[model samples]
Target: MDRFPEAFKRFEKVVAVEEIETFMQLRLAFGSWAGRKWVPTERQIEALNVEAARLRLEGAWRRETIVVRGKPHVRYRDVRTGRFIEKPF
Candidate 1:
């Protein structure tokens, strides 16, 4: 019995599902991007600070240690790989 056609269809569905899952995971992990004119207003900044303080209190903003040039540099880990990287900007 030749089940190649059905198998291929199942494989295609699996690949599509995997791709969608990856996209959703990335979106959740990195968040949406802001536009060029998206400067935070005073109120927004204050709100952000409040949220950040909440996260900090929850121990979510813990500092990470990294080795650089034979010295330890405290930095945040990259979200994708859990590796320390310098801030791009």
Candidate 2:
């Protein structure tokens, strides 16, 4: 499975998902050409799991450092909330 919607392939260029800056850009780029809904194949579902793991590393986690008792501790920030996660799930 591709990281982006299959509809994105219609464009002249396929960009990395990380380069997509906003949801509106995604909606405008792919939402208007509506079509039938479909289910993922078993193979595609496996690929989706890999893609999801990659996406988690890309966006689900952000790194931060904190001090505890004169020691530095690594932490993560929740991108949506702008708060320290301390340790991510």
Candidate 3:
């Protein structure tokens, strides 16, 4: 079966070759925000949550949640920047 149904395919975008290798390295490092080593602050976390909720309400298909530090946090790729944001819990 197709993991991403046809209806959801519109949300997918083609990533650049430079981004692919960087993305893999970051994933291996365990989902950092744009591959940054430091953690996000409480204010940033709250902002990310709000942004995620807003995106969902706007019918964005890319908004998602991920577990970090044993708690659920919002994760989304900013359309304007093309950067993966995994807000640490």
Best by lDDT: 2
TM of each candidate vs. truth: 0.25, 0.32, 0.26
Candidate 1 lDDT tens digits, 1-89: 14333433443454432332332332222222323433545433333323333333221222467688999987754344546556422
| Better candidate by TM-score, 1 or 3 | 3
Which pairs of residues collide in model 1? none
lDDT of each: 0.38, 0.46, 0.38
Model 3 segments more than 4 A misplaced:
1-33, 57-89
How well is each residue in 1-89 modelled by candidate 2, as lDDT tens digits?
A: 45443544443245455654443343333333323332445443333334434444333435567899999988767555567765533
| Tens-digit lDDT string for candidate 3 (2-89) | 3222312222232222333232242232224234633455543443334333433222124567799999987766444556755332
Model 2 lDDT-worst window of ten: 29-38
Report residue 42 deviation for candidate 1 (angstroms).
0.5
Locate the minimum summed-lDDT window of 10 residues in model 1: 23-32
- Pick the winner on TM-score between candidates 2 and 3: 2
Q: Pick the candidate with the highest TM-score.
A: 2
* CA RMSD, predictions in order: 17.4, 9.9, 14.8
By lDDT, the candidates rank as 2, 3, 1
Candidate 2 residues lying further than 4 Å off, grouped into runs, are 1-12, 15-59, 86-89
